[model samples]
Target: MDARITKAEAALLLPATTIPSRRLAEVEAIRLAAIAARDEAVADGVRRAGQAMLNAAEALVRALVTFPARIDTYRALRRLSDRELRDIGMTRFDIPRVFDPSFATRAANDSPQAPQRAA
Candidate 1:
């Protein structure tokens, strides 16, 4: 047997080396694709979180901007007499409950003094 390989032998061996290299390239491609997918998921999560924070901030700003108007309305309502309040389906006691979410329901259910409007 010869110690040196001929060109024909080297050519035949080339495919053997290339097969493993091709497999390595395919594995690298799959790994890169997985990494890209993970990064995209993380980016989407961050975007959603940022959007949620922005929505909360907008709501807070809206509340702050409307606070003085709400206070003014409360004061105006407070200045009304019992007759005026009754006509409007409210009472001096109901003034503090104006900001409560259940105020309308509670008022409708509870206030016997609330005048019935003509149909």
Candidate 2:
């Protein structure tokens, strides 16, 4: 017994109402089903590619060693302009937190150009 069975093989197991014509119809049905499955797999591959990029970015942010290296990595991620990164997911400022915890905290609290904003 062949371990692998295709849609056409499964259809062949069924009793044919019209003997000769049934084989041709079953083959066409299996071919169409195979094409649909292939297209779905292609679409899934593209989706996984995009998700891999986001996972890489997140990992890069988490693996910064020094301040300068962190800054460079943050800039690269920022260049993507992905809103998911901007909205508390990840940001350039998170880079400084590794080197200067206070600086990161203060920046989060204080507004840049505070005096200008007052005027």
Candidate 3:
């Protein structure tokens, strides 16, 4: 009796096992751990972004609500013509709208007046 085998034939006859079952188990564990870590990181980022956006919105609401007088002052100043502002014991230079926006609008609305700028 004589037996002969080619490398190609041997390879074809061998059972395919790219990874041993134990190693496959380890690889699957690692993959699952990595996926879990990635999910946690993504969730944390979303939570932080949501919190920051909420903070900014709250601040905007407070600014608009608390500073109504200041906004009104600006409107009052705007209503005055450049020439008129110059005449009424005020001036574009003296009470520059940029420096004190609240003054112009203080009297225009029924809203409570802010403390007047001391003369």
Candidate 4:
């Protein structure tokens, strides 16, 4: 019996004995790419959320800054006489509503001066 294998026999068995290093490398590369993509998506989400928070903060600051001015305007309107208020197309009662965002629409709906919409 022969103790050593021939070159042809070794060549035939080479593929079975060797590890699939190239396939393993490809799988590893794909895994790394997936991790990189997931990290980028998370970073993008965090950036968008931070920007939204900053915008909300800026809006709050602007509202706080303008609040005293709105109060001053309201006080000035309150000081006016009924005749003076009427001259401005508003009554003393309407002064409080002047600062309301929906004032124009509400006044138009409630005013005697507004034209009647036919049924």
Candidate 5:
């Protein structure tokens, strides 16, 4: 019915043939299936990359915020008197060690005077 499809005026137009509907459907189905598969792969790739980027952004934000807080705490701790540090069960020399949990244990163990627990 389309105007672009010229009506056969001669026998050489393959005029007797009707395009098969079933084969057309089959080809269309295969093409659609291929497109769906490609879409799924692209979605999966975006999801994976998005997750990794999200994690990296979270880590960067934490590091940015945490470093400033830790530095501020270190400066504050440095300003404290030995008596004040002792009241908190820490020493002037233990400031850096206190910031690092791995070294905190060693520093605590090295201390001759542990905090006396009240009965």
Candidate 6:
């Protein structure tokens, strides 16, 4: 009753916050943009990873398809005389490793070879 509060002072004393609406909206916009960018980058990385997996799968499939031929070569080598096999720098035990596509190349290189045939 004495020194009564003004309408504006009463409004200021209410529970409502004083943060500017435009500033809040700008901050929210920046956070949303960052989230969207992160989502996009993750999606792109996933897509690339999927593509790499597909490529590896295709290569494995191709290797599987060629397995029979490798086996045939091994059989042919197995049937060869030891002398013949040795001439190619291989022993009977070497056939499987040699014909296997996944064999380490260094092992193959170090394996003995048949002498070069003259032209």
Against the true structure, what is every candidate's RMSD? 6.7, 14.7, 10.1, 7.9, 8.3, 6.4
- Per-residue CA lDDT of candidate 3, range 6-117, in tens? 8989888877565369887788899999999999999999999999999999989978886877667767877888667644545544444444556545543222322345
- Candidate 1, residues 31-92, lDDT tens digits: the string is 99999999999999999999999999999999999999999999999899988887777778
User: What local lDDT score does residue 47 receive in model 6, on the 0 to 100 scale?
Assistant: 100
How big is the positional error of residue 106 in model 6, measured in Å on the Cα after superposition?
4.9
Q: lDDT of all the models against the reference?
A: 0.84, 0.66, 0.69, 0.81, 0.78, 0.78
Return the TM-score for each candidate structure.
0.60, 0.34, 0.44, 0.54, 0.45, 0.59
Best by lDDT: 1
Give the per-residue lDDT of model 6 (tens digit) for 42-117: 9999999999999999999988999898778878888999888776667777777774556545442255444555
Candidate 6, residue 85: Cα displacement in angstroms equals: 1.2
lDDT of 1 at 80: 93
After superposition, which runs of candidate 5 have C-alpha atoms over 4 Å from their true positions?
A: 1-18, 72-119
Q: Is candidate 3 or candidate 6 better by TM-score?
A: 6
Any runs in candidate 2 off by more than 4 Å, and if so which? 1-20, 61-119
20-75, model 5: which lDDT tens digit per residue? 57877788899999999999999999999999999999989988889988899899
lDDT of 4 by residue, 1-119 (tens): 98999998878987642565887778879999999999999999999999999999998998899999989999999899977776666776787788677786664345565456699
Candidate 6 lDDT at 29 equals 93
lDDT at 100, model 3: 56
Best by TM-score: 1
| Pick by lDDT: 4 or 6, better one | 4
TM-score of 6: 0.59
Instruction: Let me know the TM-score candidate 1 reaches against the reference structure.
Output: 0.60
How many clashes does the backbone of model 3 have?
4
Residue 102 in candidate 2, Cα distance off native in Å: 25
